[model samples]
Target chain A: MNPEESLKFSYYPGCSVATTAAESNHSLMQVCRLLGLDLQELEDWNCCGSSSAYSVDPELGFNLSARNLSLAPGDRPLLVMCPRCLHHLRHTHLEMQQDPRKRRAQERRWGRPISPDLEIVHFLEALIRFGLDRLKKGAARNLNGLKFVPYYGCTLFRPPALRRQKYYQAEVENILTALGGVAVTRTYNQRCCGSFLSAVKPELVTSLVNDIIGSAVAAGADCLVTTCAMCQLNLEVRCTAAKRLPIFHFSEILALALGAKDCQGWFIRHLVNPRPLLKDRGLLGPPRLGQVP
Target chain B: MNSQPMPAKTTEVINISELDHHFATEVDRRSQADLKRCYQCRTCGNGCPFVEAMDYPPYGVIRLVQFGMRQKALECATIWVCVSCHTCSSQCPNSIDIAAIMDTLRSMALEERAVIGNKEILAFHLEVLHSIERYGRTHKLGIMLRHKLLTGQWFKDVDVGLRMLTKRKLDLVASKVRAMDEINRLFLPYWRVKPR
Candidate 1:
């Protein structure tokens, strides 16, 4: 995937990626260059309405996500990283594919014809598809002995019946394997993180934070890695409110193995410092380690 | 000991007729797509962690709205309590988006200055957004201070302060984003007009 060549993906970096998780976006670009995967940022991409719109009006939610799905080029698979976005788009795609009446209702609501040909694939699957073994070969450094809990948090491989059949269910351990890291087995891997509760009712978020991080800590995980930005924000923010746990977007960890910098260059600033744990693990790379007075 | 007999006023306490006009108007203004389908199975109710602490349960809140009990529904603790987790929506057999409706309800209540209950929580919510408006992202300290100042609870949560201090969590020093001016400029209107 040459940065200059035409190896492109129809990328949908959701709202959070653009602003809050800028480092993940930057690292994604860096890894894309390293892997020679060209990403064409979809023009005029709108909010997938996240979980909000979907809850407001199911038809409206489907149409909004489908409208974005409809924007992808006919040839390329639509690439999305956020699991919430993936779940919503996948739900819409599956629903539209399975039912003509639902599709017609959505199309009528959207006031435009919708495309049925688009296939949505998450960035994790894309990386796996591109070959994790090859990715390991490209790693500038190994994540040796860095134990992490691969927190999937429900959305990625949820409602197992609907998700399993779609081949959406995956153990992130193999990707962890690619980085030469051990994925600690933790039951919180699929637990609910009390997602949107952080904004509306943070006290409940406190209990969820306790459980999620407590599970990872109990599992002896040195860190937490996830695919969704909302999950990342909730875990990181609530972790601050509760305890200090290092939670990273999966790509940030991947970027670390690629040796971009220790902790993805000040993105750690947004998080409560996880340096103490990283120090305990002796995994602190140059930049993060350098910041120690 | 014998329990005191209830006063006649207690039985006459259903002054809910006053709420009908407002409830009817609001329902007319908002979409009622699946509002009537709720059977109070409380699937959404059980999914909501906030329901236990709510003055009205999630299903009861919907029932209130459906019955045009606007004042009681708006005044219900569930409106302030819902965290917008979508667990309820996900579990809903009718696929009714109870959580988003909660958001719409909160916004409506704030717009109408109808926050008779959970004013502190509502103020905290607004203060959180105001902090974001000023800093582009939350600086926990700023939000806490602003919420405290607004709610007149500056010294009330001393135990919280002590814990944060012991944890080395409170940065007495200010932390800010570079675009503070632009961000604050963008959000000033919202803060100014937002319900106190």
Candidate 2:
């Protein structure tokens, strides 16, 4: 275990994580243990004020993220599982730095105003921080033959002003290599899958998601891996059994490579079955007593 | 944003006003995009996924914004239907964040009680905000039920919901964050965004 990877960091799981994506949360926790990483949940951390916040009131979004920023102790760089959280935090930081007047207002309002220079550690960045070389060498099992088309969705590497630069998408491919898997780069990977629209406009979401998944199928990917939980759910919900390829959170696959047993139990939460594919490929390990695969 | 043919246009003399000019400035201030920098290239309209559904496609909305046509722009479903995907921004030769500008426009529309072209999307956004205000995270099942009731679209995704319930993908229970008061403090202001 690398001593540097053992560094403790503030963790924010966002909202959907605790509720809808329990499997992702559990797998991520297990993977952290395997990597010798320490993740302490932010005490009384509020929502990052996702898409809904920004849509309702521009100022409200920044304020919501600012509240969390003030709550975040200076002990470690804040870690966020959701890319939307990463986007909101970075936006909040930049907006605060740009507007001193608003900063003062926030300070007076929060009573714990912070000159927040804390680095945001997105989950993908943390995986790379674990050192791709060490991860590949450390893998007890290799998903060598599996094809992964790493999906960035939006927010992570789009709208140039938000993301630091053109970084996360390429690092995702690198992480895929570290897992001893083939990353399909020849097709559409960075396109948005009509995220929140899955709730309001299912038809539009279906079409956009189809365009994304269609490109991956054409590129011969065995499975699609995503960083955003919203994207994971959208892709899975949009994909029918005919077009269904297991859309996995990056943490889920990382947990597998990090030697967490009972991948079946971890994936039981998925509506679209990933077990048949993983099991057929001889990756789920020998069947257990009472295991139904 | 792209180098392709644009949607068909209809000829109608656009009227601009003092208030309309002010509307453009407000949008530019809020979104930080120089509306004058746009060349009417129709690039953003070309790559937008929801263009077919939009009342005024991306470039059309930008043109309306440039002309300070606030009512015309807000009345169109284009702003609300945008998924904020940034495809247009990425393809912009002038480096304009059309998507971000769209975001600003939506917020302004909400603040003003302006004509929102998509009632369902606004309702959905409101429901989600309502959840986040109370629980600090969106309650998915709550949003679905509320949206269906609000939209009167019963039996929508019911089978999918059943499958999800069986799979335990949907959490029937809800939990609020420890700091509900703090969350409310952040939210109460936004709820009354409309003019007093």
Pick the lDDT winner.
2
TM-score of predicted structure 2: 0.92
Question: Highest DockQ: which candidate?
Answer: 2
Candidate 1 local lDDT, B68-168, one digit each (tens) = 77767767667766655456676888777675467556656656767556766666655655544444444456666777677676566565445545444
**Candidate 1: clashing pairs of residues:** A1-A36, A1-A37, A2-A36
Q: What range of 10 consecutive residues in model 2 chain B has the weakest lDDT sum?
A: B1-10
Docking class for candidate 1? incorrect
lDDT, candidate 2, B1-196, per-residue tens = 2133345676966554443768778888878877668998877777776776677778889888878888878777888888777888888899788877888888878778887889888899889888888787778889888889989998888887887788787788866778676777775665654443
RMSD of each: 9.3, 4.2
